[model samples]
Target chain A: MNINHVDLAGYLTKSLDADEHRQAEEHLATCAECRAEAESLQEWTMALEAVPEAMLLDGPPDDADLLLQRTLRQIRQESSGANRRRSTLVGIAAAVVVAAAVAGGAAVGRFTSPSDAPPVAQPPTAAVSSGPTAAPGTRTATAVDATTGARITVALTPAPGWIRVKAAVAGIPQGERCLLQVVDKSGKVTLAGSWLVSEAGADDGTTLDGSALVPLDQVGSVRVVTEGGKQYTSVSL
Target chain B: MPGFRLQRRREVADEALVRSLFAEHGRAMLAYATQLTRDRAAAEDVVQEALVRAWRHPESLVNGKGSVRGWLLTVIRNIVTDQIRARNARAPEVRESPVDVPSDEDHAEQVVNAMVVVDALSQLSTEHREVLEQLYLQGCTVTEAAKALGIPPGTVKSRSFYALRALREIKSLSPAGTERSAS
Candidate 1:
């Protein structure tokens, strides 16, 4: 019997009719192709069933409080129905700043001789225009990487009872996992978030947004660290 | 006065429901999202969006036929799909590599499977992953998977053949052979 692929799949899934099942079984007892296919399908099925249990051994990231705070902030924003307009305005402002920085930096580099060009372009902090605060206050900070010419701009917003930290980082290497850590005046360090640089973003940069449960007043500094625990840059608040 | 009291009671109930949902399934949902997005920050965004959506339609929690976790996982899958679509649209020049686009059913299956399998799936070509997802996970017939994936049924069979062969060689599964006894 020349068993078709569909017939084999049907037999494996038990979707075959009785006669088809019996015929396939008889052929499977002799044919090498049918037997190998059947065994492979069985192994695949067993592996599929093991997936959920396997995932349970390695659970979510360790920072549950940060996740809860971020979710609550999203819930509050959506329920209030004001998130869209605010997000749009923020998006526009960010675009303009990025465009200006790229264009201005290029212009300065073109006219200045190598010796005359200022080192590292002035820190990005000077370029950030602080946005107006609503119920939860907002603060802005920026850091520059002297060696890599990368810049990181961060926005801190108070959400409910926690501090929401959003950072836009540029010029980080692709495929490297970077972490954002927030340190309080009391010396407690909270892992705010971690992200990988997208293929495109690695060429330019990417913005990472995350929230932490620390109070705004308590935060003294924020640091971006690579997966290797090396601090890439730090910004004082 | 009675209306005010009733509203307060409903609010309390909603709060309890939301807390319970998070306590029971938050870690799993986060883990699943992290695997799908491959970025913890984006995973948080996916989890946040899904939870907020669940909160808005609190009735979903009570009325869902499957477990609340399943519903939440479905919601996360949809959001991630939309995010990937939007990103693709914005940067048409920089298309995701073939290996990056896991089939629809594979995304759903990954929610249940361990991150190790998810990592293994990432290693396979996108075509191979899609075939297994449709046949094994979605339980689609070969013909059905072919139609869904816009390939011929023969291609589906051939792909599945190679996919299973590759899965057998995946290094992550080697350790599991011994660990399965411990598990």
Candidate 2:
């Protein structure tokens, strides 16, 4: 007996009941045509499964982090403002701009200063003297944008409900409004703070301070993104 | 003040749930979306939308019997499908060529299966994952994988067989075809 598309779908999805599933399996073992079709489906399934790991190996574009952050923020807004349905629609409009930033592949190079031709080697330091109690050890990570050569160094000091983030960033486009965001282990992101890049500071690099509403341990990474939601640089912490 | 405290507690709980969901499955979901859309930006958009949808219907995610990763991937699939349909509608000229062999439904189903398989892969043991990763992901022969993983050739073959079997046994392998059907 020939297996139809519906049966193939059922078999592939495991929607078939036990008896039918067993029969389909038995039939597939013998029928050449059905076996070929099943093999094709299985091959596609394997290809699909391999894609994610492959992409990870390939290194996802920088803006990918920014996109996720903006999306989470939008979702939070929608959930909290359930009554303001119209505003949610407006948020969708704004998401398009964010999407465009990612698609355009904005360059995030390090600003070259007359004093320093090579990449700066300063370790990120946390200004925790005045903040709430700090965690025992400071954690830091730095990432450079391959395209723009922009660099961002994130220094995280653990706190109870919030972690103080001190970032030193260079190579951001002068005068672009940018935000510092912290993504927790669960992929939850909080706005650390926002700042405008100064023309002189862009060349010399600038330091910004902010705090995320998550403890130090919960923090996964820190990212610098343009006001339009294009990620300049990110470093896993 | 007590009422405010209760609301804050609920908010914290919800936030925690969201964070946990992302931590466990965010990478897989992003990869699945990236595959479907072929553009990191568009993929991010799909993931973002699906996540927002998840937030709106947190109960489906937190309480539903299906795997959260599977559910999230399914949502991403549907969103991609909608975007494709919208694009085709807006520019019928592009669809006139019919460059792709698989119909939208077939592609969508394949995507669902792919996500399920990826999620299953994540559940495998480190050894199982390593064997499969070397063989399938890195295109290594059994001997090559064994060499790379510091295992014997025979063990590599055996591990590969069992890993495949384990992948086949993942119970929630069905594609969540639609939003209504997924829940």
Candidate 1: stretches off by over 4 Å: A1-30, A33-61, A80-237, B1-12, B93-183
Q: State the lDDT at A147 in candidate 1.
A: 39
lDDT of 1 by residue, B1-183 (tens): 643332332233233334434543566567678777767888888887887777666445334443344466667777876776665465546765545545532553444334445445534665666666667655667777787777887777767766766876773443444222111
Model 1, range A177-227, lDDT digits (tens) per residue? 899889887778899999886765654456677888788667767777888
Against the true structure, what is model 1's DockQ? Answer: 0.08
In model 1 chain A, the worst 10-residue window by lDDT is: A91-100
Question: Cα deviation in Å at residue B92, candidate 1?
Answer: 2.2
Each predicted model: what fraction of the native A–B Cα contacts (within 8 Å) does it retain?
0.12, 0.10
- The whole-model lDDT of each prediction reads 0.54, 0.54
| Candidate No. with top DockQ | 2
**Pairs of colliding residues, candidate 2:** A109-A148, A109-A149, A109-A150, A110-A149, A110-A150, A111-A171
For residues A70-103, could you state the per-residue lDDT of candidate 2 as single tens digits? 7657755655666344222111000000000011
